[model samples]
Target chain A: MIPLSHFMIISAALFCIGLFAVLTKRNAIQILIGIEFMINAAILNFVAAGRFDRVAGGGQMFALFAIVLAAAGVAVALAIILNVYKHFRTINPDKIDTLKN
Target chain B: MSAEQLAFYFFASLTLISALLVVCMQNLVRSIFLFFVTIFSLAAMFVFALADFIAVTEVVVYVGGVLVLMLFAFMLSNKELLSGLQNIAGGFKFTHLAGLLICGGMLFLLVSAISAADVVNLSWIKNGQAISENDNTIHQIGIHTMTRYLLPFEVVSVFLMMALIGAAHLSRRERRS
Candidate 1:
């Protein structure tokens, strides 16, 4: 039997990778991609831990909701990112500082 | 190691490598395409974890819906996106090191916590066989959603529709002043 620790370690690794991408990447879409990775990692953790529960499957239900919410979030974020690109003609967050420091 | 162990390692490595490339590669197109592989392999990992329903949903909702949408967004706004792609090697900034440090620390902490908890022999492992045998995750999920999780299910549907409509409205052409 594959232990839960294996899955937890993998999910943690994936989350860290996503965090790295989100922190260092220059493009807005790339950051969104990192966010997707993080969400998937969290979902994997949920499903992995949920394997213990035989009756309720609460973890799977939560994963399902998380996936749906992620899709919706991506849709809205894409629309907003596209609008930002239109206004600034650039997707790099560093350059589009219209809010001013 | 057993076949299950080998397969789990295979899919896990595939997901991790592709994810690493997706983040580290300088080419935007390569990263985007690699994201497909990463997500698909992750679905396989979901299967390994016995999340059968989530495995299918991950593929359908992610690969079918989200990926295509992202691809279209990329094609629509092709310019200025790649300018940042080639500059990674020109100068390694402090942000890069900071990112690496923070992520590495987080991974270390997670590992330490996992080891401390003794998750391999949890109290529930006595029923591990029963859990594995009852692989009808879809059926379980359906019953729970219909009975216990009915409210959240309906709420999520409403949330999804609202998001789509809002995205459409937001992305529509703005009238000139």
Candidate 2:
């Protein structure tokens, strides 16, 4: 049987990678992609931990709710990004300086 | 190394590699496609972890719905940004280096924590038969969603409806402007 630590390690690595993307990427869509990666990493952890909680399946249930929430968030975020592009004419977060003083 | 172990390693590597590519690739469209690979491998990993229901939902919602929406948004937005050459056209800067350092430190901390932790294996295992017999996850999830998780489930549905309306409202072009 594979140790639970193995899954944890993979998820951790995935989360770091996602964080790196979120920090470095200038494009709003790229940042959103990074955020999606982070969410999936968390979902991986939930499912892996859920394997041990066989009776309640709380982990799986949480993962399900998380997935739904992520989808909804992505939809809303993309809409907002689209609106930003409409006004700023650029999707690069670094270039959109309208809010700056 | 058994079949399950082998499968786990394969999917895990696939997920990690594609995730790295998603971050490294500059082309927005290509990055989105690589994101597809990342999500697909993650779904496979979910199956290996015995969350078959979550795996299917991941594919349907993430790969099918969210991905398609992202692609559509990308296409509908600025035409100049469509090509790979023009997307993210810039040199490396200080932020990239900072991100590397931060992420490297975080990875180190997380690995140490995982190594230090003691994960108890539940006695629910009965010669592997118990694991195989516990395949009624879908039924269990359904029952739990209707009972213990009913409130959250209803809230999620309402939240989804709100998001749909919000997206539609936000994306509509203004007449006066």
Tell me the tens digit of each residue's lDDT in model 2 across B1-177: 799898889989999998998888867788899888889899998887788999999999998889998998888775776563364466778999999999999999999987776544434422122223357889888988998889989999999999999989998888995
All candidates: CA RMSD (Å): 2.0, 2.9
Clashing pairs in 2: none
Candidate 2 lDDT (Cα, 0 to 1): 0.86
Where's the lowest-lDDT run of ten residues in candidate 2 chain B?
B124-133
**Model 2 error, position B44 (Å):** 0.6
What's the lDDT of the predicted structure labeled candidate 1?
0.88
Task: Write the residue-wise lDDT of candidate 2 on A1-101 in tens digits.
Answer: 56767888999999999999899987788889889988999999998877766667778999999999999999999999999988887797878877743
Kindly provide the TM-score of model 1 when superposed on the true structure, using C-alpha atoms.
0.94
**Deviation from native of the Cα of residue B78 in model 1, angstroms:** 2.2
